[model samples]
Target: MKKGLFIFCFTMFIAFASKAQDNTSLPAKYQEKMTSIFNKIPEVTSSAATSLIDFAKSMLGKPYVYASSNPDRGFDCSGFVSYVFSNFGFKVPRSSREFAGAGTPVKLADAKVGDVLIFTGTNPRVRKIGHVGIIYSIENGEIKFIHSTSGKAHGVTVTEFNDYYKSRFMKAVSIVE
Candidate 1:
């Protein structure tokens, strides 16, 4: 009886070890199985370009909070961008001004989705990147963007760069992947 118990325990231990090893050094057959499970999201937009849109869509209807960083708690303008991109593995700067430095500066005509839009409209006295938003789409010569606003309509909302946005438009930068 003692001999049988010893063998049983040893076999169990070996099986456990093999399973652990297989996790790291996965067998080719098991890897094929994993591919089916892994949702390989296709790149609708170029790298880093659509990360914001994907993150924002997932966060639709989240409330906006001042200086809050988490999606559950909602986010501020800068926090919203920071949380969204960072969640998708992109290293985004925390504040709006810092994030403005992350990408290449794109002209208004050259602006594309996933580009960071900076504005000085938030504070007139300041001629720097005061507010931030992510470009989502452009249609019929109209540009739409997603950003967290304060007080009214607080949360991530898609606003257009029509006359209203152009009035407050500062500049745009591209976060090249």
Candidate 2:
């Protein structure tokens, strides 16, 4: 009967709609930002946090270059973030200057370990957004971050968020979940 045929078509339509939902893929950035998308560690269980650290630790001791961001090889300030985020399926900005404006701004008091620290007062001004790092710790009023320095003391290193860093700091951004 016509009525029976209508019911069958309606049911098919509903099934197809649900199926479409399952086929949607998240943006590379959001995918990495999701808390369950990659390998995890105790320091970070969420995908964003884990991805950020993995990106940093993966380059331990790698020499800092002008614009490199490859762990198997070398990395620069922005190259470091771009490489790691892209490695895990996130679309990070290509340059440090562009990267400075990619995340939600947060206050120093409220910044979490996974937050991004932007610095622009060191050498090259924020003509773009220069110098970025991942927050490693925020304990007892002190903040620590990991980044590649290219001054007298260069290379990827971890340092505290003190007057030295504060003076050159651009702003803090929350680019991860």
Candidate 3:
């Protein structure tokens, strides 16, 4: 079963790698970085990934509170991610910026449930990791993530990885194994 999963993930990685080659919006250097990161994703167990995702989902609709890691008082983006991973005994970084180098990077197209999705701050012009989320699902080619946002949703919500997010996407990472 593990071999089968690894094969499937590798095949998906190859397909996405080819597609990534055509994307010219991101600079060549950044593309290389992403590819390097994608190559380092470790084999992840589905059960663990599912458990983490389920725990994250249970917090749906929780209010968004900046700089907070407490579920009772709400959570900011990184705080929410930190809270979830910590529950599973994973010592993840506490801040979004710190996550850039936390775990093995996974390609966005190959991101799986429980993977961490990192994004630039609200202003895409500033290329720095300022937001984070947990991948909830990828259905029919549409990737959806669960995150705590201060946007229109105003709280912990599942959001589509649409153009808005794509523009700000920095990298995805896998911390579960």
Candidate 4:
């Protein structure tokens, strides 16, 4: 009887241990994994990110014209991004899709202000990158970006990485050292 009781107690302990490990929330586990992955990438200083962000902001209120890079005539999503980065003397890819594979990819959680945020449409029917933007800020742990959108806003604007974009977010690429 003592041996049977001991075996039962051991089985219960194993079950309890397994349950405790499985109890970890998915979000917490994801967060932990992201934190570790982000740690490997070099840190992006705020000053560097701010410099690129400032340039993008300077064109705020500019109209959004498809396939146009002319700031005076208005800028499209990729055009605006390429234009701004060109000013920094970096020749970036011309299309949003091209930009996706341009720089060293940094995870979204590790993205800094200057990192490039790629996205598909708000509805996200497509798997290709259709839009590009520069990370503008991280407010209250939320990532925001400055992009020229052809949406209702219809111009260069700063937007929070809310549910709309969050669901569409592809990945972030660090163009600046």
Clashes of 4: 0
Q: In each prediction, how many residue pairs overlap at the backbone (N, C-alpha, C within less than 3 A)?
A: 0, 5, 0, 0
Clashes in model 3: which pairs?
A: none
Candidate 4 Cα deviation (angstroms), residue 118:
0.6
lDDT of 3 at 173: 95
Can you write out model 3's per-residue Cα lDDT over 35-111, one digit (the tens) per residue? 67555544233779878888999999999998999999999999999999999999999999999999999887788
Best-fitting candidate, scored by lDDT: 3
Spell out the clash pairs found in candidate 1.
none
lDDT of 2: 0.71
* Error in Å for residue 172 of model 1: 1.1
| Residue pair clashes in candidate 2 | 35-47, 68-75, 68-76, 97-128, 97-129
TM-score of each model, in listed order? 0.68, 0.66, 0.74, 0.73
Candidate 4: misplaced stretches above 4 Å? 1-45
lDDT, model 4, position 77: 95
Q: Distance (Å) between predicted and true CA of 90, model 2?
A: 1.8
lDDT of 2 by residue, 1-177 (tens): 999999899788667645544333766666554434222323434657766776677676677888777675667877876776677677678776676668788987778877778787475433335688878767788888877778655777778888877877877877775
lDDT of 1 by residue, 86-144 (tens): 77777878888786578788898988888888876455465766778888898777888
For model 4, give the RMSD to the true fold.
16.3
Q: Which candidate is the best by TM-score?
A: 3
- CA lDDT, candidate 2, residue 44: 32
